[model samples]
Target: MSLDFKPGAFSDFFRDETFRESFTYRNSPDAIRRFPFPFDRDEYMYSVNMEPHVPGRKGSVFEKTFDVDEHYVSEMIDRAKVLADDPLRCQSLPHMTLAGWDTLELIMEAKARDYPQWFSLTKEGDRWHWINRPLGIDHTFTFLDESTLPYGPFEYIMRQTQGDWTLQDERDGTLWLDAGVATSQADWSADFDIGMNFHEWHAPVPLAHDLGVFDRALKFLLKLQHGSPVRRFNWTMTVNPLLDTSPENYPKWGPTKTTLTQENLGRKQHLRVELQSLYRLPRSNAIAFDIRCYLGSFEQIVTVPKWGRRLHRIVRDLHPDLATYKGFIRNRPAMAEWLSKYDDGAPTSPGWWPED
Candidate 1:
């Protein structure tokens, strides 16, 4: 199988690098093909041990990354924000504690610390970012053994792009999946607002464009929408087990399989996965779920109880560190230079807004 994609689009992510970090192909270098091509192409398979900072936790993270046909990505983005005011649509998917952020930054930092050249690819401030943006910046992974039953494998489909990599229950061979998880091929802007009623959320940020423009857009959009002068950082990680492909049949993932109507099941490869996205909101934290199947076929939305007030806040020396870390850009001149165009640029008297 081969993946025939727009070679120019990935030129940035495919710069000079160590062969060990990348999986071009096993026997065939052109295993992963792209574009108007007709074949099962290259699939990304990585094992992540999600237990670095956690006291005593371990699990496995196998993921497949793919870009939705440009048109489909736009459609999903529209679907995600169809009614921007809907609480269900605008909530952040993944919410982490300050510790998690530290770990995440540390991981990215390690890549830079080890390979300064690769640092530019992993982090922002590059030519690709000049036009494209970045999404899914925070990635945490661990291993899942036969034990942790209740919180085991999240979801899986035999013939899909994204699946959990696991050892066969018989301990015979390895079972793996190549699935499409997400893409940062667009501008996804969001904000927490207080309207006449309770807190309202506005997610009008354009969520679809060239993946190239995502990182720059995400950093700018996040600060504009969620950053606050009094904004405090906290560290927390929510865990949920959706799929249990283990043979032991442990009481792991309790969520039931979400069955979609045959009509919605576009292809023969259909499997329901209940995965939750965690996010820290101003008022309450959230874990929004989607009984999604076929990677991007369809999704049934679900959520959990909100993280109430009273969670401990970890204070940090944030003023100057904003640029080196989060909060704000250290290079005001660079930032302003980036935001020169008002039509889709920096904050004007009215602020950067969405198209009505």
Candidate 2:
């Protein structure tokens, strides 16, 4: 599915929208069908549910190495606004420059290969020419030369790409969160998390630590070979389609949580899912953790019968601790009650697929 992203050329392929004030963000019908609903069954729990980041059925988020959807352009705009307000949202320690280049290479190559019409890259030894039509970027530079780009390699490419990312440097038998871009994160602080080790950064997560999910995940990631990446899902609830849900700016968005009611809950409440993928860079051996976010309003999600039913069960039965940790404990009862109207006590099929 080639998209028309040429500058100033309007097309339904790229939506013009906002994720901030007057929040006009929405999912098209196609996006709703392909929403990455996290639960496989009627209940939810924290686990190391990692899977191979391989291409899947067409028209699905899993169909590409880095899924680019209708939200691509607008999401990039939102990220730029976030960075403009808080430059610290994107930071790379001095030692992680090589890893940044590695990440830049990975995204550019994947996007050019998977989405040729919108992106193109050509390389001659170390010199590279890259083009991103959607963002109106066209440049030629030495591959590993940081001076050639406007920002660090990681930040430069990340600004053009969707999702929040953390480049983890492995040493002392653990991964270090030395660098990251977390503007659209789910209530986490990249500024505070920087330089923390694997466990240290994940210490805030609730039941996962006691379940040893991180221990096993960290061990598995340490052995992750180049050319083989793993992906997982992490999710929470948000009041609106606002993407910049960072802790630093919580005062701006936190108050909005109190505004939900059964009347507006279907339109305002959103399930924020993170399609997190981990990769082992060939040269630097650093792991690039891509935390891609996908937001679907309750109304958009309930359009699918299976999703509607499963979501009701998951919300109603979700453990209290997980709800509190996810920052939606106050609204869980309202959400569950609202979702129960769509769940007719029918049996849902086995997987996350809506068409099945």
Candidate 3:
């Protein structure tokens, strides 16, 4: 689990168009090997779909609890580029400074536990030291002093980890999105969502509000425990390999909705699976929503016969409202056709695939 990321690994990754192009293909085995394929049934629906983070899952290339995979360094580099392009992607309210420190401590501890060789943390009195060998970051800072860390406490933590994090504060029996960083949002805007309650933030989701899914989710999130982290998987399709698909950059990627055709469907379309984890900070009474995105194409998905057939059926049968909300109305038909052409006509049942 210990990866030695060279000093310029990220720069090298970004500069190499050929290396980046490798992942954009439909039959990239490397992508499929690590893909968090999100469908389990022919029909997809909204649900609470959370469970305790169990380690050593069989299908995924990385662990479910806290994973640092091959894309760790590259993705962090992508995050930095996005944040530089727009600092608004990372925000923490002044009152949430303490919560920010708590998040940093929690993430550092998790990194050390999961990848001890590459990451470590040590504390002596109020002075704490964090060492991230891969990033060549070694610094000592006062646990709660904003001046000691170059960036906001939460921002500093986000730089070292692969997942984008959001901290929700619990107040008056409700959870509010008080602080955190997000560079890889599905189509939502973290800046616009700040200060909104769980239900308000998820308002755009198709049937969650009508079916009381978000209400039940909010209740479950508020009752989450400190040691036990729960995770759920959500998926959407994007036209590009890029991760910064927030509403702000919609103009850049939004047009791809109508541009997809059977000719380019396999190479242009990607299934984006988000591994979202919810953790209750021990000290701040805040919930940390960590999102890690995994992308794969129909070419790679079809390699697994069941995944191909299931995805074809799901897209073909998806409710119109849900498909529209997911920004798939214009392109899904083309994608379904491409998937069907590649499918091997495998027999699949609803219970065949495991839930994330």
Specify the highest-lDDT model's number.
2
Error of 2 at 68 (Å): 0.6
lDDT of 2 by residue, 1-356 (tens): 11122354435698888898888999989889999998888888988899999998899899999999999998988888888889999999999999999999999999999999999999999999999988777888899888888888998988888999999999999999999999889999889999999999998888898899999999999999999999999999999998989999899999999999999999999999999999999889999999999999999999999999999999999999999999999999999999999999999999899978
Please list the residue runs of candidate 1 whose C-alpha ends up more than 4 Å from where it truly belongs after superposition: 1-83, 88-269, 273-356
Give the per-residue lDDT digits (tens) of candidate 3, residues 1-356.
12233444444223222113344323235446557777767789889999787674554634635776656666776777788799998998877888888888878887888779778889999898888876767789899888887887888888777767788999988888888677777888779889998778877787778889888888898899988888888888887676778899888778767877777787678888888888888878888898887777666677777788888988988888988988888877788888887556666766434322
The estimated TM-scores of all candidates read 0.20, 0.97, 0.90
Ranking by lDDT: 2, 3, 1
Pairs that collide, model 2: none
lDDT by residue (38-89, candidate 1, tens digit) is 0111111111111112111111111111222222222233223332323221
- lDDT of all predictions: 0.20, 0.92, 0.76
Candidate 2, backbone clash total: 0
Ranking by TM-score: 2, 3, 1
Q: Judge candidate 1 against the unseen true structure and give its global Cα lDDT, from 0 to 1.
A: 0.20
Error of 2 at 115 (Å): 0.5
Candidate 3: where are CA atoms >4 Å away?
1-31, 58-64, 349-356
User: Where does the lowest 10-residue lDDT sum fall in candidate 1?
Assistant: 302-311
Best by TM-score: 2
